[model samples]
Target chain A: MSQRVPVHVEVNGRGYDREVEPRRTLADFLREDLGLKGTHVACEHGFCGNCNVLLDGAAIRSCLMFAVQAGGRSVETVESLAGSDGELDELQLAFTEHHALQCGFCTPAMLLTAKQFLRENPGVTDARRIREAINGVICRCTGYQQIVAAIAAVAQAQQTAHSIRIETAPPVRVAQDTR
Target chain B: MLAGGQSLVQLLKFRRCRPSALVDINGIPGLDAIERRDGELHVGALVRQQALLDDPQVAESWPLLREAAGFVGYPETRRRGTLAGSLAFAAPWAELTAAAVALDAQLDICSAAGQRSLAAREFFRGPGETALGDGELIVAVRFPAPAPGTGAAFHEVSVRHRDYAQVAAAAQVSPDGHGELVLLCVAPTPHRVDVSEALTRDDAIADLLGRLDPLDDVEASASYRQRVAPVLARRALRDAAERAHRRAPA
Candidate 1:
């Protein structure tokens, strides 16, 4: 038996300090140890995106990263994407409204990836770019058109909201300097 | 152990691999750098494919390498897979080997004994095998200063956009503006076809074709890969030449 190593991690807005084997993967830790089953495990390999999670705001394959490796880091799963009041976020709502999921095997990873992709590529409302960004995750149940639609819907809404914010906010005059 | 696991993990799920233990090297610092020193380029072993493609230095300086990195897989796999892992592992059929061979790159390997450097010609021994002995780790790879006015290109045929290459070829034209050719994936290892003598003959293609013994395999027949090898080689040579000419200082 491998020796149990102590690990401190922040998951889904909660801090966890526990002892686990050095060999325990972060995916297994999230699902089995903490009981945050939102992060699915499929294929066990990195090929399937079911084990995808955000490690310090970057999407990565959790199975390939060991739990001990995630020590002293903030790890976010699909569960954190929910609203603070426990309601679905706009992307989750868009997914449901568009019927973007069927078996839901790849939903958590897909949602997490799509969430980060949209935030980074703000105002890139093109359907082709959305497909290219989410191409990292693998989905066999849905044909992927509806998922793309959900992401597009969210991007369009964010753009509109940003425009409104710009229009409503107070503006300050700036002085130009000639050097 | 290589932590990227793009190819190794797939083999594990299929029960084709079962290593006694895996040493995670992803956390190891200073192994993912892309450095340029004294006109030579060095890419660290753990440098990810995505990072390699995104670096402007790599893109502008080594366009052929950039294109090869983009063809590895989708964004996710590229985010973790390393250049040294692919070269050290070789992974049966790989396009990077062909590119490295065409570019005359050097492999910097470090083991308990010491550090040694081997040219790509000597590093790649055969399919799915390399010159690296047990307990040794690939530290970095170095590319020689490209000849002035030389260009290079990499081409492969695959079923899907991201699938492994069925038959990949990389070629570079000489800087002297004379016709010179280097062929990859033409043998068990990436072998260069010596076309110097043949190029001086009337039918250069015919002379080169007569001296080939391409092996048959599951991905592609030896003869078929052999036949298409020169076609892609010719195209790569032309493309690389054009790129070199465009970048050469007047």
Candidate 2:
């Protein structure tokens, strides 16, 4: 006898409802059941981060979580990075510009991992700190120099944009407005 | 329940652990809280490792736990892995296991019958084992916050910074040189050794490493652990004591 567990998850701005076995992993559910192949599974163990995804905006190893655990939560896969108009996000654009991928097997996880890193750390510019942020997402292709450069480029641009926004904004003359 | 699938899901995928059902404990409330109450730091079963690392109090008050979380796994894995799950698994080299043992943490458990508690030192029976019985679920892990003049540090030797440590050591130093030294990945469990008196004779401490009977495995040679456990222990002791001295102002 077997039991089926029901899960309602929002994946990449889309909601999905399914009844999966309690044993099916989030990686398997993402790739097999939902057919979102962007989440690649390698080394099925937690050692390799090929199956990394974002659970509630935090990077998590998809292979290490069951789908039932993801119930009522929002899951963002590598597929979520690109927009519906087929445009790349800032980090994706930087990845392409820096030649971050060679074989591209680890690209999906690299993208999601770097995305979450940049999100959690908004103004991080130190090279060592950037390296530590993405240390878990291993890429045998580009030797990590390009990957580090890609994520750093986005963070740098974000910092620049943030400072510019503060400097260029119009000053408010009415300091106190009580409604 | 899905305490943290970092290790459990992998075991399921490889057909290593075939449990009849999973409880999916994420739906439960209050199991993910990390708070201080009754003079103890309570870490719920679902409290992820990142939460502990991010807490300012845990960082300043119990920095050894934060240090151990950094070495547990990759950044993504840490986002989902939980402390109680790691302690329940009781991997010999697990960072939090050594931290729990060194801190003398207490584990709170619950079942259909009600609730109970166990000491960290008494929890782990062997590799991949704990004292938790059937129907009993680890509700939270309570750590006695290090007292005034207390300092602690965790150190490990691994091929890569993120790999499972070959040998791990954690030391909590208090005033008057009474400290607790625990070593991991060297024996069948997180081995806690009272270093209160041992600190008086620093030169003879190397002989104490022989009690662990370090294991041989693919990660490293048995000789490597034997050689490194004491070295790491000495390093931890020095740092821990130095930190303790910092806490006790002149």
Candidate 3:
């Protein structure tokens, strides 16, 4: 029998200290230990990106990493996407409005993956780049067209909001008037 | 041992590897540097695959590594996968293995005994095998800069985007038309072929194809690999030569 190791990790902005088997995956640690079932495990391997989560603000396959490896690291899962009041974020709202999911097995991973992509490539509207960003997560439903559309819509909206913020900024005033 | 548990963890889950204990190397400092010194690009073992891909130096200097890295597992896996870990795993179809061999990179190995450098060509003994002995760890990999006016290209045909290649080719060419070509997923280890002569010449392609000994795997048939190997080789060579010519001094 293997020994259980203590792992101190911050998940979804809350710190947790638990003793877990060395072999336990981060995906299992989140789902079973912390009861964060939003992160799904499909293939139990790296091939299916259903178990993806943000490690130090980068997307990584949770199943491909041991829980002990995440010690002292901050992990963000799909649970972090919604607010404490249960309000969906922009991406989730776009996913719902665009009908980007069917069976929803791959939704959490898709959201996290897309979230990382948008964070990295802000104001990106290229469908090809968006498709490539989420290519790791395998979705057997919706044919990926709606997912692409939903991500594009969010990106477009973000770009518009950014430009508006820039355009509406107050003008600077000079102390000396030169007429 | 673990740098990034991208592959080792999966192996553990599948019971393919049952190590008594795992030494996590992710916390080690200075092992993730990607820098150039002594005319060689040094990539530490802790460097993630995505870090190498994102390095502007790698993209500007050793573009072949960038091209090959793009075909690795996926964005998620690459963010956690380490280049040295990939070499240690030594999967026959791993793109970085072929890129290392083609670039003639050197792996810096360390152990209790001492340290030594091994050529990438001599690193892989077979699928999932290497010359590394017990207690030995690959600390970093050093890639020598290619000659000036040289260009490199990598090409592969997978069942799906970013999937493991059925047959892949990595090539580097100089302005003088001299080059090297390495084929992946066609042999037990990366198979290097002489590409000094232009592939367009008669019998050149035939001679290159004759050197391959691909096997029938579940992903593809031996005949299928044989058929596509030459096409990829030609395309890679042509693209590399064109790049070399473009970078050539006027």
lDDT of 3 by residue, B32-77 (tens): 8999899889999999899878999888788788888988889889
Predicted complex 2: DockQ: 0.77
For model 2 chain A, give the 10-residue run with minimal summed lDDT. Answer: A1-10
The prediction achieving the highest TM-score against the true structure is 3
What DockQ values do the models have?
0.45, 0.77, 0.85
Q: Per-prediction fnat values?
A: 0.44, 0.93, 0.89
State the lDDT of candidate 1 residue by residue for B1-250, as single tens digits. 7567776656655778777777778778988888886776788888887887788877766666776776677676677678888887775456677667766789888888999999887887777789999989888888775665556667777655556566666656555654435444567776666655543453465447565656576767777777887676666666766777776777
Distance from true location, Cα of B115 in model 3, Å? 0.9
Arrange candidates, best lDDT first: 3, 2, 1
- Model 2, span A30-136: residue lDDT tens: 99999999999888888778898998988888888878778889999988888889999898899999998999999998898888878878878788998887788
> Residue A137's C-alpha lDDT in candidate 1?
83
TM-score of each: 0.86, 0.94, 0.96
Q: Give the TM-score of candidate 2.
A: 0.94
Model 3, which residues run further than 4 Å from truth? A173-179, B199-203
* Poorly placed runs, candidate 1 (over 4 Å): A175-179, B8-21, B147-152, B172-186, B193-231, B241-250
Ranking of predictions according to TM-score: 3, 2, 1
